[model samples]
Target chain A: MNAILECKGLTKSYGGKKALSDVNLTIERGRIVGLLGPNGSGKTTLIKLANALLTPTSGEIRIAGMKPGTGTKKIVSYLPERNYLNDWMRVHDIIGLFRDFYGDFRPDKAYDMLKRLNINPNDKLKTMSKGTKEKVQLILVMSREAELYLLDEPIGGVDPAARDYILETIISNYNPEATIIISTHLISDVEKILDHVIFIREGQVVLSSSVDEIREQGKSVDGLFREVFRC
Target chain B: MLGKLLKYELKATGRTFMPIYAAMLIAAAVTKLISALTAGGSEVPEFISAIVYIMILMGMFVMTFVVMIQRFHKNLLSDEGYLMFTLPVEPWQHIVSKLLISVLWNLGSLVAAFLSIVILTFDEIANRALMLDLFAVIAEFLTIFGPTGSLVVLEIFLAGIATTVFGILLIYASIALGHLSNRHRTMASLGAFLGLTAFAQILFACLTLIPNVRVLQHYMDTLQESLQTSIALFHYVMWFTIGFFTLLSAGYFLITNHILKKRLNLE
Candidate 1:
């Protein structure tokens, strides 16, 4: 079977500045890979490329043996860092949107998640707090039975308690046979759940190894991240 | 997928349009009532209501234009783009869905405006006769060409639709071109629109300068010579106009789609 994602000499540049350069990597299936990086470290760019939001400047990247496109989008459930929901829609209306577009979306799963979070189905997004909106977004993303889940900064802006809930939701809800590439800077928070860690700095992959390998070498992923990315 | 995209597009844009249409009808009803109650007395309320009705009719069109621009920009090119572009649909489906919905709302507002006017004058026998006479004149005008007249009328109606689609696609293309720039996107869009408009006008002007393309005017000049030839020329011109706009709309569609697919910059 093909790796869940593969990149060959993938490079992306904005104007003259390269966001990602010569990025050659592969991510296998069924692993919770932490794509650890700092701000503006091309983590979002890489995620955006995989989602087909932005075209790569050169080379190519593939998802499950197919290029990033409608086919790839079908199986990759993405949770962008920004609030992408419109203010005019209610929670249920958004669920309906997901149901209309994503064949793999589980509306029952989405409603259950919303119920557990105490988010009313009829509540308008405009009235919801930022944290509540983020939770709702996360719930919608996690409810998809997708083959690959690309979550960009899933815990970046939430409080510690909500962060824990988000993490727990991510752990409990995702498809076990699928892969999850979480792009985040909060290393300590997500370190425990991650089976593999890929350290990216200055738009280049610095380290790609399993968490067990790092632990065997007597270093936590967080400690290694601090050493590699300290300014 | 296009059908689903259009369904959501309608729902999203209808929220802004439906209320205004209802307001227009209500204002028309109030105007009629105020004029009826104060037939020979105070005209102030009637005047105010009439003005309100007119303002709403004008506002509906303005809002239609604003919503068209906003739907394309905000829904497809802003932060919401993350959700939209990631859907398992092609970029052209997004453009076509938005275009279809925008055209639907445009036609809906026109129908509502005409309905509101009819409501304001429904009770007046003179106004009813005037409208019937207008329709009779149009009917008589169509019956002149016999069977060909209906086809001519259909062509004209299609030309109207083609023109509307062309205008919307032009705007889409401008916005897409503007988005390629990293800074001053709105300004770039406006510039692109103005630039495209001027180029089209100049191209048409240059086309008219060619003697071969002056067949439209030649047909008009020879109208007294033969009615049959004039009708044929009319059909030719209408088809040419329809085809011209459809081709242009296709060009604009391709430009917009290419930009959205490969050159998208949703920063």
Candidate 2:
């Protein structure tokens, strides 16, 4: 499979401090990859850089052979770490907005997912709980027929049951030819679904391997992560 | 696409503004009813005039507040921006949408306020033949200008509206530019606003000084003498104003696009 995302010597800094430093990564198509990292490990920074939300201090990144811009943003579905959906909008209005803005937005898919999740279309975002909002966001992102789905901690604020539903929704809804990158430190729960894993520590990738390869080495991804991040 | 953008833009702002519009209408109707009830005799009172003026001022204040708050929420805090930026549309579209909505609302409020004042002070206005005379004067002015000159006047009016929109965008761009910095976002916005105002003043000063140059002065005198008619002068001013607004709007658009595209940091 061709690499859908390529980053070479990607570096970002806030003021004088580094957020991501000299990081290199390549992600192929049709893979559910886990970006595992502890707090302040630059997962969000990397995701932002890839989404063109921030310009790199130095180095390069390419999403599907195009630099991050309106062009790349067109084919990339991004779920920001926080609730980026406007609180004043109704669920149906949000869907309408997405459909109007993105040519690849799948409203039927989103509506179906929301129905399955028992989420009302007319509910205001402000009234929904945080977990529900995250799920709504996830549903919208997953509904898109995008080339790459960049999810920053989709399950970070949700309960375990909702997390499972989010993961399942993501898995079931995504186009098989596309890639999904889920950035989170919750390894054990996501480990079962992630085909490949990239572990980031201190803004650098320390491990990149397939789940089967790690399991074949007589250790689970969770155990390896503990060993690698051991105090 | 512009139509769709404008539809949603109006919807977002109308959430707050619709209630205000309704209140203004109600106030206008109430004032009309009260004034009619109290005008038992032929004469209107000085106190009534004062009340009318106060009501007009209040309406204007409310309108301005609604505009400022809508802009702040839509451009700054609301997730509406996420949808805004992600649109296949360009940055200019966003600016245009906001500007159009602001102008539309302002015009609507001005008309409503004017109608309210008319109702409250109907005796005075009718006694003075304000409505009839005003329409007659406008007709006479248009007749003097003829069709082409009237068209120029219309163009000038539209340019004036565009300039007002550009002014609003400049404020937004200033704020966005200031927020691009990591430290002192508010202070930076204030500084940027002052700097932009100073730059505009300098530009105006330079334009004013151009006629002081010998060669330019001679050219201006020749042009002034040749274009002596009011219609000609109106055309010149209209074209000049259009050009000026077009330049300011271009600058505003460039700055806003650059900030949104590259320098955005959602703090």
Candidate 3:
């Protein structure tokens, strides 16, 4: 496999409950992979493992042929589900922080994104609406010219217009030599832009295939999701 | 990268600390001004003025601990951890950044506290003899404890600095350990902190009782009234305090690093 992301017997658990279990997967570079799963279907667990936010139970995860640490963190840009920006800092301060830490961060590009969305650079995060804060986070993550992007629920909690903008931002900003793994519940909204899709269910990988392959089977990705994970 | 982390750490803390320090200094000046203006008119209650000064110092002291705890918890264990740990820096950089900034602020508050007291309470008219009064104080201590008393005093002062830094790192280590909990993290941290403090205090208290009381008793029984003996005892006590806290500081630093690197559960 020409993989940019790889997991071997990867397992993670909290207490006695398994979040992910004995899973092996790989995603090639230069593709937008949608990590589709139910709310507690281990999608975020897998992503967090990749980000080094959570340690595994029994196995290993590798990104870009290296373990997750200072080295891999250099090339992996992560957009967490929660609002992680410090409320007291101005928008520009966060951009400065990104610039300071990530060598791949493009401040000009981030500024352009911020201006396009009408966010004031000098505004504190507490002054911004929740939607604006989410947009700012997306802008920072997307501005990084990293080898891997792990965005967890990127389009959630935003208006449709902003949602469209975020999706378009993801599409237009895709680097042919890099990989993007977006984990979200709004599969239909993101399916059109996704090049590959993986469906996880209850700590197991139920399906992993390309979007074209799902279409060749005469089924929309969203349709297959509902069929696979119905209540 | 370490420099950048330190810069941001300072920036993050300076905003709140600077304002508090300025307000305390201003309040001290205002109290002095009121006392100066009322020197001849009517008696301003000394107790009330004393309270104002003490309260400012106490607030600064308490907030030193509070702010350090909050900064470590909120910055490294809360949602902000997602931003921090993802940065292209080793986890130790984060710990060191917090440690250095915390020590800087702790020492800064102490200096500010001392200066505020001097500014508020010093009387210029009596200040004409302040130099002689200082020498008189030195001579008094010297007669009681001898020449090495000065060295012991210096060592004690240095020990105070080490103790503060070590105590702060103990809190950091406790909080790092508490971060292992998915629920009750705050409570866990508080318990760890109190437990560690009690452990260190008990350990140090036992060590103190072993020699301080016994040595003095032995000196008295032997009828050896040499000032040099007292000076030697003073030096040993000061160095012991300094060495003990330095050891605590190193131990806490290692434990904090271990938990942060191996058992990190930033929920």
lDDT per residue, candidate 2, B70-187, as tens digits?
A: 5744554344454455556655566667767777776666776677667666777777677789879888877767767568667967896777676776777777778677788778
Residue-level lDDT of model 2, residues A79-189, one tens digit each, is 988777776799999899889878999899999999989999999998999889989988988889998999999889998888888888888888789999999988898
Query: Which candidate, 1 or 2, has the higher lDDT?
Result: 1
Sort order, lDDT high to low: 1, 3, 2
Candidate no. 3 TM-score: 0.93
Reference-based TM-score of each model: 0.96, 0.88, 0.93
lDDT of 3 by residue, B1-267 (tens): 999999999999999899889888887887787788777766556447767767877898888888898888899888999999899888889988998899899989988987787777678535768758888987897667655657766796789789878978998989987787777887998888898889889988887887579887866675576566656666777898898899889888898988877777666
**Residue pairs clashing, model 1:** none
Q: What is the interface RMSD of candidate 2, in Å?
A: 2.4
Better of 1 and 3 by lDDT: 1
Return whichever of 2 and 3 wins on lDDT: 3
For model 2, the stretches where C-alpha displacement exceeds 4 angstroms are: B40-83, B121-130, B139-152, B212-238
User: For model 1, how does the per-residue alpha-carbon lDDT over A1-231 read when each residue is reduced to its tens digit?
Assistant: 789999999999988999999999999999999999889889999999999988899989999999988999999999998999999999999999999999999999999988888899999999999889999999999999999999999998889988998899899987679999999988999999999999888889999999999999999999999998878
Instruction: List, in order, the clash count of every candidate structure.
Output: 0, 0, 0
